[model samples]
Target chain A: MEVKKERSNNICTLYVDGVLDYSTMEPFVEKVRSIEEGIEKVIVDFTDLEFIDSTGIGAIINLVHEANTKQFEVELCGIIDEIKDLFETIGVFQIMEALQEESD
Target chain B: MCSREFINEQPREINKTLEREIKLARNIQMKLLNGKQPYLENGEVLGVSIPARVIGGDYYDFYVLPDGKLRIVIGDVMGKGIPAAMLMILTRGAFRSAAESTHGPGETLTAMNNAMYNDLRTLGSFVTVFCADWDPKNNTLTYANAGHNIPLTVTSEEDIAEFPKTKGVMIGGLPDQEYSEESLELDDRGFVLFYTDGIVEAQNKDGEMYRMERLCDVLLKSYQSNVKDIKESIVQSLNIFTEGVPQRDDITMVLLKSR
Candidate 1:
């Protein structure tokens, strides 16, 4: 997968393209880890993402966990219906909301 | 010269030991996962798991309750290989202990989450599980989901439907999750297939997935067969579709058919 980073003020947006799965997750993890300090919000755009496996899902969960620890806002946007259904089935939204609440 | 030779030989010996240990671990996992399938009074149940590596994180078990109900569970732990396998054992232990005392599938999941939540969260892992109780006397299946895919039900030759929606947070996503249960009354010839995502997510040489459409079609054609035959047909179809491409995740499924 490819990640394109764009920054505006204190918000950082990551545009992810291609498949995010076991074989292609390292770069994504690295990108998430490399998010610069002082950013108030992080946005992940999934408009171009084609597929994601359980490992990919786990990586996103870890990112959410990081958000809780690091004290930043995370927004996931442009999720297609298929991926939305998958995220819902796996309770990704619930986890995100719960962690967000904890941080608050 | 003697010291140099000893160092080289020591590395080889350590490699051999590690390989042997991994093999032993694999054997233990297989034994626990493939233990005896419970005999149903008027139905047949079968479960199969094929790990992508030497050991996998996928798990399934059958427990015959005191009231003659058969409890079934299938789960996929996050990640893969040895670490995931270790947590899978933990999950199995929790499930086994919980199934003995819990009244229904929902309660069993709640118990399992309570048992395993702290450890799983500390380790930064989660598991998606689907638990169900099949009552042969009444021909009914009651099930609950912990962030797992819903099983498919084949009621007629031409129609298949997902089990009614039931939702809960995945184990380790949060503490003290209480899963809700849904029930389905099965026809005498009905078939229910519970599976992990690996079956549908399997990719071919062209990087194309073996999508649900194909799976549903195969199930429709094979639903009339016995549980074992139906499972084989699905496996055969997957084999043909993948065309020798390596599987990315562990494939697991449990089949229940009213006899």
Candidate 2:
């Protein structure tokens, strides 16, 4: 997978392309982990994402946890229907919401 | 000179010992997972798990309750290999303890989440589980989900769909999760298949997934067969599709059929 970052003001958008899976998750995890401190919000764009395995999902969950700890907003956008369904089934959105609520 | 040779062999000896220990761990896991299949009055239940590595994080179990209800659970830990395998044992222990006291599938999941939540959070991992209670007397299956894929119910070649939806966060995803339950009445000759993501996600040499549609087609064709045969059909189909490509994740499933 490939991640391209674009920054505007305090918000940073990450465009993910190709499959985010077990074999290709390291770079994505590194990118999410290395988000700059000054960013107030992070948006992950999944329009070009083709597939994600459980490991990939774990990486995203870790990112959410990091966001919660760092007190930044994280938004997932452009997720295709299939990935969205998978995320819903696995309660990714619920975790995000739950952690966000706890922080609040 | 002799001391130098002994030192040179020390690393090899340690490697061999580690390999032996891993194999022993694999054996223990297999023994625990492949324990006796619960006998039903008018139905059959079977579970199978194939680890991608020597040991895996996928788990499934069958517990025959005092009321004659069979409690079944299938789960996938967040990662693979040894760490996940260790967590799988933790999950199995929690499920076994909870199944004994819980009133239903939903309660069992709540208890499991309560039991394992802190450890999973500390480890930065999670588990997706689906739990169900099969009542032979009523031919009804009541189930709850915790971030796991819903099982499919097959009545006939023309009728196959996912189990009714029940929502809950994955174990360790949040604290104090209360899983909700859903029920389905199975007709005679109907069956339910609970599986992990590995089956549909199985990839071929061409990097193409096996997909749910193909799985549904296989289930449709094998709906009439016994549970063991149906399991074989699925394994055969996967083998045919994957050819010699190595498995990437742990595959697990439990089949409950009403006769």
Candidate 3:
């Protein structure tokens, strides 16, 4: 997957494009780690993401786990139907939703 | 000039030995992967794993618990080729060791995760697995998953398929991970298809993926066939879909049909 980062004030948003699989997870993890410290909100935009596998889901879970440990907010937006179904099946959104509720 | 010839001959001898050992390793792996199938009076279990290379990381095995329950596991180690193959052997060892002492699929997975977590983390890799215990007499299949794709169940009469929903993180991702088991009763003439991602993520020449929907379609069309025939149908469909493009990952499947 190709990740483009945009920063404004203290918030950082990642725009991910292309297929995210086992081969692409290292670069994706690096992109997530590259965000500067003290960023309040971390947004992952999946508008251009076409395909993702279990390994890709694992990377997202790692990102969510990082957000939890580091005390930051993570928002996932623009998920396509298939990805949404996959996230739901794997209970990714449930964990994210629980985190959001905990933060609130 | 004589010394140079001797040096070249020594290198060639080493190369020949290395190639011979690799071939031997491949044979060992194939034998392990295609081990004896368990006999279930009311059911039939068949598994096929095709490595993209001579030997690959995808693995599946069947073990018969003392109580006569069949324990089956299918896993995909991260990446492919030699490094992944070595880890695949490690994973198989862990599973066999754990299955001997564990009570259920969940416990077996927990044991495997505990055993392999350190090694996998040190190697910067992970494995996804789907474990199931089939009780043929009871006609129930209880399963637990480690971030693997949910297996699809298809009936001979229905034109659609459904996936069993079970959840857990990938093995080796976190230490002390707990996997929960779910049970489903099988229809008399139905089958459950457990597969690795390579089957669905297979890409065509135009970069279009074969995908899950198409796989479901193939399964639905072949639901009336025997388990072996069903597997052949899926393989044929995949070939047609990819249009002879080189395989990128290992394709593996385990099917259990209620007889």
Candidate 3: segments with Cα more than 4 A from true spot:
A22-30, A37-41, A61-74, A88-104, B1-25
Model 1, runs deviating above 4 Å: B1-9
Q: Score chain B of each candidate by TM-score.
A: 0.95, 0.96, 0.92
Could you tell me the lDDT of residue A89 within candidate 1?
Answer: 96
Compare the candidates by lDDT and give the number of the best one: 2
How do the residues A2-97 of candidate 1 rate in per-residue lDDT, one tens digit apiece? 988889998989888999877898888888989999988999999999888887888888888888888998899999999999999999999899
Task: For each candidate, give its TM-score against the true structure.
Answer: 0.94, 0.95, 0.83
Docking class of 1: medium
Model 3 chain A, poorest ten-residue lDDT window? A86-95
Q: Quantify how close model 3 is to the true structure by its C-alpha RMSD in Å.
A: 4.5
Relative to the true interface, what fraction of contacts does candidate 3 keep?
Answer: 0.11
Q: Score the docking of each candidate (DockQ).
A: 0.75, 0.78, 0.23
Over the stretch B117-178, how does candidate 3's per-residue lDDT look in tens digits? 88976765778888999987888888898877788888665545555677786777666878
Candidate 1 residue-wise lDDT, B1-259, digit = tens: 6456557777778688678889999999999998888788798999999999999999999999889889999999988889989999999999999998999999999999999988987887899999999998899999999999989999888999999899888888888788989999987888999999999988899989998999999999986799989989999999999999988889999999988
Distance from true position, residue A56, model 3, in Å? 3.6
Task: Report model 1's TM-score to 2 decimal places.
Answer: 0.94
Best by DockQ: 2
